[model samples]
Target chain A: MRGAVMYAPGDVRVEEREDARLVEPTDAVLRLSAACVCGSDLWPYRGIEPVGGATPMGHEYVGVVEQVGGAVKGISPGQFVVGSFFASDNTCEICRSGYQPSCPYSVIMGSIGTQAELVRVPHADGTLVPTPAMPPADMIPGLLAASDVLGTGWFGAVAAEVGPGKAVAVVGDGAVGLLAVLAAKQLGAERIIAMSRHEPRQRLAREFGASDIVTERGNEGVTRVHELTGGFGAHSVVEAVGTQESMMQAIRSARPGGHVGYVGVAHDVSLPGVELFFSHVHLHGGPAPVRRFLPELIDRIWKREIDPGKVFDLELPLDQAAEAYRAMDERRAIKALLTP
Target chain B: MRGAVMYAPGDVRVEEREDARLVEPTDAVLRLSAACVCGSDLWPYRGIEPVGGATPMGHEYVGVVEQVGGAVKGISPGQFVVGSFFASDNTCEICRSGYQPSCPYSVIMGSIGTQAELVRVPHADGTLVPTPAMPPADMIPGLLAASDVLGTGWFGAVAAEVGPGKAVAVVGDGAVGLLAVLAAKQLGAERIIAMSRHEPRQRLAREFGASDIVTERGNEGVTRVHELTGGFGAHSVVEAVGTQESMMQAIRSARPGGHVGYVGVAHDVSLPGVELFFSHVHLHGGPAPVRRFLPELIDRIWKREIDPGKVFDLELPLDQAAEAYRAMDERRAIKALLTP
Candidate 1:
């Protein structure tokens, strides 16, 4: 088997690795059909987040179950499935409340690296959702998107309480942000504003149901949103880029009593309490509970109701993993799809 | 008219002030029945918040309408009313959404100083909710509580999403925190945990329906809450003290995906984004939309179903306002009522 490994910042290589095997009785070994480079991957690739020596890369994946341990009852070998990046037993109080990211018995599948030919998924019965059947070959990218990005964006929208007749503003133009636009649209937001300066991403944003596009950043972007929403800011604002500026922009871009759903993995950001206290906004976000939305997301994708896969602009064979990382890291591609 | 004025930190004086008169067409002049020294007043008194000049102090009041401007249609002279500390038009989009504190035309009643014989209330028709009729003397204290502390505490509980079968933890033992326990009970919480170290406040908390009391602070307090809830923390945590430690404690005391309703006037606090992100908690709070809850709260008080006013541990005449402030500032009283 071959897997992508990050030896240092900006250095990624695909090398022959030992085959993945089920470690726990509740685990399942997956022969990955497709994997992708996530926007979060750029954090370490840019050296902003520490790259521990020889780290296994990738968490987003879609694959067919190759083998299952004795205790895996719901998932079986040969079934095509999409699993959340965070594995959870799904029966805990946290998981039942739809916060699998912090589930007491949760496991991070990222530690096992999904950008490989085979990977072990823990708590298979709870973390993986099977497709109705073998998804058509062309549907792989979209299902793979459901593994992380699509579900993440969906969570952002849901956290913002996006609903019919809402005016939504999305910060950041990365794949997650773009998909949030799609999620807001699906959630019935009446007006969608995508904040982006990139023309290509702007076009894609519009295609994904953005009613308007504001190229400004920070305060200027907030002002644009207010102007577009009759000076009340947006009813719901999604923060997909985890930064002080983006978070503040999202907060300022909402109407008093509006919601700011931030899904960005906050880095060196510290929110001033006084401002948040007086902003009169509802704030909720974190690493998304992707597993909670996987079944619905898969159903939507299976019915061709949404095309989240369009976020992928570059596709490569698994062996060219280095090129895939570079393209995404350099912003040359919104997302890079890798086929194992 | 005599009103409480803060000339400097720890320097409060009851001085003869100009007569209160209607200003805006929506204004109403009220002959204050009662006013109170709030926990927030101690902020400036303690010199933690700046006292730029001789500022009039106090916002909580239940009064009889002495006069009303021509445009005041909903409220009239001779009506005994319970008004929110924040005057809101209550017709704006934000107000209709139940966030009167951030209404575009909202006015802070504290600036005019309700701790006086008379005061002018703006947006009277919207800010003041009349009691069913003139209440008996015993109900005066409770109705006055509804003016601010009760409403603020209720907002905290509501923001924390307190409801049946939920575990609620209140972080501040102040008047507002005590009343939040009352609010959580009214909202049907199955278990109410009041976090307090004071013996008197703990007794008051129990009277207000606190099922348990934890006397620890900071991390130890969080651990105690976890121990109380099978290590999952409280489902709803109300934060009533505005400080870094209290805010962090409230957040830490809630389970993942739990609610933290904070109502303290934040002085200086900064939340680490990374910690909040990983905490997986939902945060919503601000100045209490007291006007939004005034009607329901007043009704409960009128029916004698709740005794929120039990939080008032001291009462003084209008001229003894300085003593009232001193007692509350010194933590000798949970709250002080001033009869003007």
Candidate 2:
């Protein structure tokens, strides 16, 4: 099987690797149907995050179960399934509390590298949610999106408490942020503001239900959000960029008693405790418990109620994985879908 | 009028000040019945927080409305009332949202000096909540407690989402934290863990319905909380100490989906964003918004359902304000009430 691997900064290649197989009693081997490059992947690609050696890449996928371990239940061969980047036993106390990413027995799906011809998933019964039926080819991208981005965006909206009559502000223009706008809209937010200066991203944001757009950044952006909301900042803010500036903007852009749902992978960020305390805002975020929203997302995708797949602006064969990474890294593509 | 003044570190004196009068159409002059020294006041008294020359001290007070401004509607002269340290117009958008302390027109009651014979309260109609009747002399302490500590503790418990079946952990042993234990108990928390090493405070905590007491500090304290909660941290954590160590302990002592309500006035503290993000805990807090809980707290105190005033271990004439501050500063008294 050929899989994407990174040897060093800006060094990505598609190479032959050992075929994946069921490794545990609760494992399932999946035949990859679709995989994609994520913005987070750019961390190591751009050398912002160090790479030890050759590392298998990719964690988002939607595929058919090719083989199931003897101990696996519910999931079986020939079933189309979607799984979160984090494989959780869904029934644990933590998972039951809707924080599957922090589940004690969870496994990182990225380690298995879903961007390959074949991949092995552990805790199959708990990790994989099967579709009601084999999804059509046109639904593949949306299903793949549900594996992480869509569910993540949904979690961000839920964490921010975006609801009816809420004025929600999104602080990033990435796929997750755009999708967050969609999620907030779907969650019944009365007004959705997308902070973006990029034309293309801004357009997508509007299409995703953003009622307004602020082309400013940092403090100016926060001021604009406040100005748009009558001097009281937005009631709910979704922070998809984990930089210090973005986090502060998100925190500062919320009104007192507001909520901030931050999903960005934080880097070298320290929040001034005094400001956060005085902000009087509720803050909750992390690597989203994507597994918690997979089922509902899959249903919405199946019903064509949402087209999160639109986030993938480019698609290529799995053998062109390096190009996919480059396209996403260079901002040439919002996201790149790979087909094996 | 005579008031407590902090001229320098450890220099507290009873001195003459301007007599209180209604200056604004919405203001009221209150003849203070009782004023208590707060843990926060120790910051400046101990020189942790800077003090300007001859700063009029004290913000916690229970009193009788001596006069009402022309615009004051709800409150009347001769009424026994309780007000938060921050006076807000209660009708503003922020106040309506239950964050009165952050109201656009909010005024700090301490600036007028509550530790005096008479003090002017601005926005009287919105800031003061009158008791059902003049609270009996014996109930004055409890009503005074509601003016700040009890209300703050109750806010912390509510912010922490304390409810039936939830395990609550308190991160301070101060009067506010002890009252938080009481608040959690009243909020229906099934188990309350008071983090305290002091024998008297621990005993008071238990009397306030603390089901367990963990004397360990920092990481070790978090470990004890986890051990007590089946290796998962408590469901709710109230952070009543603003230090970095206490903040981290409070965050670390909560389960993945737990809530952390922090109310201590944060000093030089900055929370690492990455750690907070990955904590997967809901964090909300600030200056307590005591006005939000004043009514209920006053009612509870009046009915003798809760005895939060028991936290005051010392009483002195208003002229001995210096001694009152010294006793609280030296920890010789949990709290000291001053009567004029």
Report the Cα interface RMSD of each model, rounded to 1 decimal: 0.6, 0.7
TM-score of chain A of each: 0.99, 0.99
Name every residue pair that clashes in candidate 2: none
lDDT per residue (tens digit) for residues A1-340 in model 2: 9999999989999999999988899999999999999888988999988998999999998899999999997998999999999998888899999999899998998887988999999889889999999999999999999998888888899999999999999999999999999999899999999999889999999999999999999999999999999899999999998999999999999999999999989988999999999999999999999888888888888999999999999999999999999988889889999999
Question: Candidate 2 chain A: minimum summed lDDT over ten consecutive residues — where?
Answer: A290-299
lDDT of each: 0.94, 0.93
Candidate DockQ scores, in order: 0.92, 0.90
Error of 2 at A229 (Å): 0.6
Over B249-270, each residue of candidate 2 has an lDDT whose tens digit, in order, gives: 9999999989999998898889
lDDT for B172 in candidate 2 is 96
**Candidate 2: chain B TM-score against the reference chain B:** 0.99
* Model 1 chain B: ten consecutive residues of lowest lDDT: B321-330
- Which parts of model 1 are misplaced by more than 4 Å? none
User: TM-score for every candidate vs. truth?
Assistant: 0.99, 0.99
Candidate number achieving the greatest DockQ relative to the actual structure:
1
